[model samples]
Target: MRVKVNALILISVFALSSCKTQVLPENTVQTDIKQVVNSADVVLVDVRIPEQYAEATAKDAVNIPLAELSNNIDSLKGKKVVVFCNKGIQADQAVEILKKKGVDVYDGTTWKNVKAIQEEK
Candidate 1:
């Protein structure tokens, strides 16, 4: 038997294939980020590996690897989540994944820099 690729599937495949996987510098407003962190309803998650995170994740940051994000949706929903990976690709992907699930998300590089911003306040 032969199978045909539907137009929607083809379009989706092309769309995702064309999607950029690069990690850009964060554009999430810092002032708003600080406000949200103070709200105690936000989660700053380090999506890198445990070893990397154990090296130095932020004060309130949680270490939940990117590959496991789907399994931990309940912990991410209905809150502001700042996701960070080693350099940022995984974090960007996490932001997209969470946004699709109706979660408010941000993509910062890592807890190190994010903490700098928080400390500056």
Candidate 2:
């Protein structure tokens, strides 16, 4: 019985370990969104649904949902990008994707923070 329980625990551990995961950087560089917004060279990408983007987003931010990011990678290449979502979850994922493709991207995390940065003097 003890051996069976141990085997079950080991199997559960293995199952959990095999799941795909994305880890955020422990020391991510602070994203100066205000600076990005003011710069003509930078592109602000809001990686939320179109409806969410239409409801609220930073000025000049483009709507490209996380699922559609890969399709638009070519257009985003060779440019400074700042990514933000409703919260930070999808934004972090988008940052990871962009970084893998050699895009200079800043993970802006929450939209509220990005908005505040834009509003700051």
Clashes of 1: 0
Candidate 2 minimal-lDDT segment of 10 residues: 24-33
Can you write out model 2's per-residue Cα lDDT over 9-59, one digit (the tens) per residue? 999999999997877674356655678766779888999999999999987
> Tens-digit lDDT track for model 1 on 1-121?
1235577787899999999877744543344655654456778999988999989877788998989998898878777788887777888898888877777787766676677767876
Q: What TM-score against the true fold does each predicted structure earn? A: 0.67, 0.71
Model 2, position 110, has a per-residue lDDT of 78
Query: Best candidate, TM-score-wise?
Result: 2
List candidate 2 stretches off by more than 4 Å: 1-33
Colliding residue pairs in candidate 1: none
| Clashing residue pairs, backbone N/CA/C < 3 A, model 2 | none
